[model samples]
Target: MKRYTKLGLILTIIVTCFYVTTASAQGHYNVLKYGAKNDSSKLATESIKKAIAAASKAGGGTVYFPAGKYLTGPIHLKSNITIYIEAGAEIHFSDNFDHYLPMVKSRWEGTDVMNFSPLFYAINAENIAIKGRGLIDGHGKKWWAYSEVHVKKIPTSRWQEEFKRLNKDVLAPDLPGWIERGFLRPPFIQTMDCKNVLIEGITITNSPFWTINPQYCDNVTISKVTINNPDSPNSDGINPESCRNVHISDCHISTGDDCITIKSGKDRSGRKANVPAENYTITNCTMLSGHGGVVIGSEMSAGVRRVTISNCVFDGTDRGLRIKSARGRGGVVEDIRVNNVIMRNIRDQAIVLDLQYATTTVEPVSERTPAFRNIHFSNITAHGNRAGYLNGLEEMPIENVSFNNMNMDMQTGFRIKNSKDIEFHNVRVNNKKGPVVEAENVVGLQIDDVRSQKPVAGEAIIELTNVEGAIIQNAFPAKGTEVYLKAKGAKTSDIVGKANHFGNVKTVVIQEADVKEKIKLD
Candidate 1:
């Protein structure tokens, strides 16, 4: 009798432990349990918040929403939690402007300010994720309509009045005057100062502003996501600002603005933060109908470096592989490498490096001077492009840019200005205009095995002005070309050529009256 009693006690203990382990493993806090009604008419804001709080208090677990439509406002995420919307579930953000009240710390167009909170926000959290094959609708029509009425193209008189009001309300606002007084919209999903974040397998639509924006975060992975916002203004697909160690892969983005823009900050505010968006790897992404395929910034004031983009396809984009910044935005963008990129139906330049992006006047060389260097492009093929423009600033010229194995079919060929240490190897452009290659104010230029096809007027195939230390070797111009090389400038010297075939003509024109020394040709 004593032995049987001891065996029974052991069995009871084993059964109790099994139940505990099972409960721990399946710790899913359903929103329905927290008074969240699945009816589309009801607002599930408080219930969802309760669910998140309960799960967080219980050492973190999944906040699950079953197959139904849950309408809410501004879902805030916490640490050590995962919000999983099951298949056929949808989270629709309400259009109530008052619901996003009590502004939070956020960035609007690269400037830090206290604004309306993002649709989904998180701060100072770790190991947070929003995953599942569901849908997130931002209900952005109201925001878009509001911006059109108040923000876009305000009258000059109204602008002055608004500026006065902004200065009076907020002391020294950094953003534009039009966007100062509650005109700037919030992003769809924003996480600041968070770590170990994962956003995967979700279809997002109609964002109020930028779709996925992560600022000052680390170890972020965004994969298998689809963003479809075709007509909303400023609806950028994914923008990573002041973040590090990010990976964006296998995303299909078709937005109204830039597909993917990497930035740090904008102006003085950006320089004060002193954090750069670096160490990013973007691969196997499809960009469609955006401003640019993969843009660096018009707002990168806090130096961006060490980014690699490969195996991407850009169709019907305005520009491909663009980097733009103005004078007052002081940053150094370097070590950017792109390979195996194919572009079609490009509306503007296939590749652009414009240091004079927005501002027209030149400023003194200081910490605010923008610089681009050490950028390399290889194995790129572009068709139906207008031109390839590489215009740098006179004060701070673009340096150390290389292009290899490029085949372009465009209306005009390359127009390089105010650059140094440029090289083009095995490059071909079937341009439709004369003067296929034009270079001005260049230093240390080299063109190897470069060819152009069928000039219309037999004009000079390559035109050089104010260039120094130029080497042209193994260049084959088209037949009926008037001049193989036309060199003219006071500073043009050391122009050398070897093994070049000047088809049907061998005329080299050098205006050497004001040249410092005679040009050397071999």
Candidate 2:
């Protein structure tokens, strides 16, 4: 080893520090250095792909984009590659649809198809990441113009015949024409059949459709990402389909559709695949201007389970914490727990669990019947149009759902229909319209410390129709309560109330004279 002088060593140390701090260091392949134009004038698609090839050939390195605007088409990511965009750097994806040519295999809207490639795509890869304090713009104005709202038939919908190969048991007749109808928009960043994926610290905007979609992926973590896509059609922020071990935190999402959606697959294909989207933990997220804050299904056919959502705030979303599935989608949504969530300015119900989401036809219990059960919500506060809506199926009613310590101030109250084994503890709904709890065709309903703070005069505080067994205890009712409880319908029976202070209630219980034997206070 040769000895160095003090001055030379100091200079060498400073240079080493600078090189280590730079994003385009020796181990990193810089896009600009690989003939990628930094200006947005030229297409850098080939150069960026070349840089990724270099990095991947070198046994995995970072492909760096440093402090400039890069115009590129589709970016295909390989395994063991990291795309790092430094601060002040932006990647503008081309709007020309031809750039995404050759029609890669992609799962569009819970159906597998060979459609347009995503802006950034990967398949069957592992240990991939796209993380930096930078921006990835899809430049989706041209794509949005292809929507059916403006154009009747989009060019992307030409793959209808191809979709039939993957899934022939299509329930929706319009599934094939979805692309032509401009219903299936390509995702911004999509990874399929991959593992150990991460997307962090990036700001994504102007996505064509679902921004970050991961299909058949595992060990995915998306954190500290800011996604804003306002007034754009089908621009869901993040959708993880048939994925497991997903962790999403510290994200701020405001999209036209759902902020975060979980899907498995579509009807029979999903069941045939038998891959459930499970083991998800979503916490510390802020959602605004989206259709739903955290939505599940409307596409779950393989089943969705073991999901935990905590410490999330939803503002200006149409609905918050929703789970909806329709008939012909044979799946079970169970073992879901939500805690410490706040919702305000919700256009629809704060929490909704509906089995009749996209279909209206009633079918018999079979492999095509969807079910919702074993869901629990606690420590939730909301100010919305309605507190909650739980509408189950006539054949298979929702089962074993409980809500505890929920406080809400809404224009309307909670609506529960076609459910069983439901419990509400320490729940308060302050609404201006209708009854606090309007439950119909319910069996085994339990209300403990539950009441309407502002009960309407004419409408009963709690209306029960065709209810089999209802037990109310430890209730806290405010003054000017006109009717504490009302029971009706031919099947209504076994209304029990105990341990309640009823000094302010004008009427304790009201029973229809015709069904007096069927409905009475015990």
Candidate 3:
């Protein structure tokens, strides 16, 4: 009888503990009563900090930000914690830049500096999440206006001239003191060297610079988040730099700069750092008022590789898909695959692959060089105002570029310069029919099933200048529209194509015969 009573007591205790643990893990850790000695509306920054501290002391819990304008300065996020701002809650940032001053380690323009601290930041924290349908307003218009004025005053040529006179032996611009003057402000959520982070369903707006920038993080997923920041200058949506295994999806971004940018590092400072931003997947996103719908690097000296972007839409953006880098940036961006893209009302080219960025002047190029290669764009539909351009630097003509099943309605056809080993399969570009295809300084070109609405004034569907081993195979007229191949000094003997094979690149017009094998449909 005594033994049975002891067993019953033990089971009762076990059941009670299980219930307590489960209940503790699933509810809100309200900050109303966490040592707020006075009122909640008063200076409760210390009280909220204490509440978070108490939660951390008890092995991590959700720090709930209730409904109100909770004004606070920088809040440091701890590990094993999730900050859930309720549906009506808003955590407003303190406006004074001096409040976020006294510099922390952060990255701006691919270089690490000790400047303005981020509003909500963490370093090396695991299992962290910022999830809820709440607002994180940066209140950064005052700072953004100041920084833009600072950048505009300092021109590159003027800086170059000043550096030449000041320090004759210096190669790069010596701007340590200039940078120290607090010109470049940091982002809102600048988490450095963190792991296992997820930011979902939150609306982050009004950033001083780029909205959400996670530098040197791994295993991060940012989905269903709406980033709305338009007033501020250089307000990029999400910039994941030098990170790995990232997935960003279902986000609507409207900003002043590039909507989503993938970068590694920049210039001599970035190349010396040696961290590559790789292994990212972006899908189901919409962008507005940005430089590119999806962009990779004007500042990637450490390289970007193995990126896949699909099922995205760009409306009223500057360019649909842009890959930009400069001569001094010695990096390789390869293995990029883009599919199922719908672009409309784009101001510039539907797709641009340019090596010389931010320059109109022509300079010498070299072969021991940085270039873009192995890029595949398939199943894309675009309505563009101008012609798409594929410009590779003189030394590094973009290699192994393939375009399959693309349908474009533009004012002009596609133009290529200084690129080699290019292929266009089933590409139909409808325009006023001046020059359907133009290629300069290319090698080993191929065009199959390429058709246009009007007759190209130039007799060449393939116009090549300084090109070698160019081939135009299986191209024919469609709907009374003419097809021609023009190459200046490029041999027609090297080209091969059936005349009936020319039509629309999006759909096949020519049926396969004995000599021409049907490219297996995928």
Candidate 4:
């Protein structure tokens, strides 16, 4: 075991103590009583807002809400205030549509759009908290009603007319491009240009659009929150759009769209905005059901960088840890680290990095470039049914991709396309069927301690096309076709594991006598 220095040991002890002490002291908040009888509903919103405002004015304190069903429109939060709710408190949004008018700056699918303001909207604040056990329900039925009415081909002219009618008060000529594109619609908690925000230990459910949209913020911490949104059409759980220095930990998110999507911005407008969403850390979270678990982008044209996720579980999700971007969306996603993840029953690829996203028409590849490089995954265990695909486009081949100590029990093969500087260490694919590792248009590839179960009848376990400077050092045999390497113009290839290196790049078929020790799985 590695040794720690004296200062490191002292700091670790102090941090553990501080965490326990602070957790104990967290539930101390003054409760102001309000009922729905003594003009209760009318005074509840103002009372709660006043409590939070008083806390903020007094230089940071807690505002407590006891058990009750309080009706309100929009509850604006303030800096240096903590809103704590008891476990039985159920704060409900008013069902009236007019209660939530006056649109806010938000988005959906990378489009800047508008609709009813969120139930809890804060702007440009600092050191805020919404902690403790309770529910903040954004009664989203009205918003969903509008969505269902709009999606099913409502005659183009009629749709435009309805949009104009709904947004009559919106500044017509000055509305942004996203407003025109029908994005920036609505969400539950839209916080823009805020700093040092803390959202911990709350249940947020039934959001209109993106559940918790944090745009252009810094030093935000979202922990131990259960986000539940099952309805379709723009019900994302937690979208960190154009934010920096975020840490999301110990959250269970199940939503209709991407569970926890990281977005910088979208398209040329996003690029022109020029705000890079960077330095996010997600740990100890569980993703139950969603389009994808912890997705990076289809909306990352501005940029996304330096993300770290660890000790997470993805179950029954479409994909586990996906990084996707399209062509002409100029962004660089680099230095991503995913470690200690366990994925089960993945509907799609266990780990996927695709550069061409949302392009079903398959246009001619000309000006499509999105740089993906330096991504590392380690100590991951997966059991799934689909293929594991890592695809980079012709113009933007991936660079420095590494998968170390991965044990995958899968049903399909693994593929890599148009990539460079890839490494796989101690990687075992128990496909036991066929095509374990396939690479095309690759360069600087290395596979160490890679083993697979062969198919009953097929080609080699490894296939290479137009790849250069590739090395397959070691392999283990199970059944079908063992290890085959085919490269037409591939040069400078070396295969040296329990076998000779240097010369004769032909089929150096080494027998079991020349193989190394077998691994023991307990």
Which candidate achieves the best TM-score against the true structure? Answer: 2
Clashing pairs in 4: 106-184, 107-184, 112-184, 113-183, 113-184, 114-184, 432-453, 433-455
Summarize candidate 2's per-residue lDDT along 104-208 as a digit string, tens digits. Answer: 888878777667889999999999999999999998888888666567765544444444443344344222446335335589999999999999999999999
Comparing 1 and 3 by TM-score, which wins?
Answer: 1
lDDT of 1 by residue, 391-449 (tens): 89999999999989998888888889999999999988888875667899999999887
- Note the residue pairs that clash in candidate 2: 157-180
Instruction: Tell me the spans in candidate 4 whose CA falls farther than 4 Å from its real position.
Output: 1-47, 56-60, 112-115, 148-150, 154-185, 360-368, 454-456, 479-483, 486-522
Minimum summed lDDT over a 10-residue window in model 1 is located at 166-175
Instruction: Residues 1-522, candidate 4: write the lDDT tens digits.
Output: 235587788899999999868854653344454233222255366666666666666676777777766677777788777778779787777656556666555455554445556778888788777888988887777567656435543234443454456655543211133345432336777777899888889998888778877888998899999998875557878889889999999999998888898988777656767787899999999998898888898778778999999999999888998999877666778889999999999987899999877553344544235678999999988888754788887766889999999889888767988899999888878774556787878888887767664442444556666666666665544544433443333332333334323232223232232223221111
What order do you get sorting by TM-score, best first? Answer: 2, 1, 3, 4
lDDT of 3 by residue, 270-354 (tens): 7777788899999999987787899999778789999999999999888999998877777889999999999998898888898
How much is 168 displaced in model 1, in angstroms? 7.7
Model 1 RMSD in angstroms = 5.5
TM-score of each: 0.89, 0.93, 0.83, 0.81
Best-to-worst order by lDDT is 2, 1, 3, 4
User: Which regions of candidate 3 deviate over 4 angstroms?
Assistant: 1-23, 26-28, 35-45, 149-151, 154-182, 360-368, 454-460, 480-483, 489-493, 499-522
Report the error of model 1 at residue 514, Å.
Answer: 5.3
Candidate 1 TM-score, C-alpha based: 0.89
Q: What is the lDDT of candidate 4?
A: 0.72
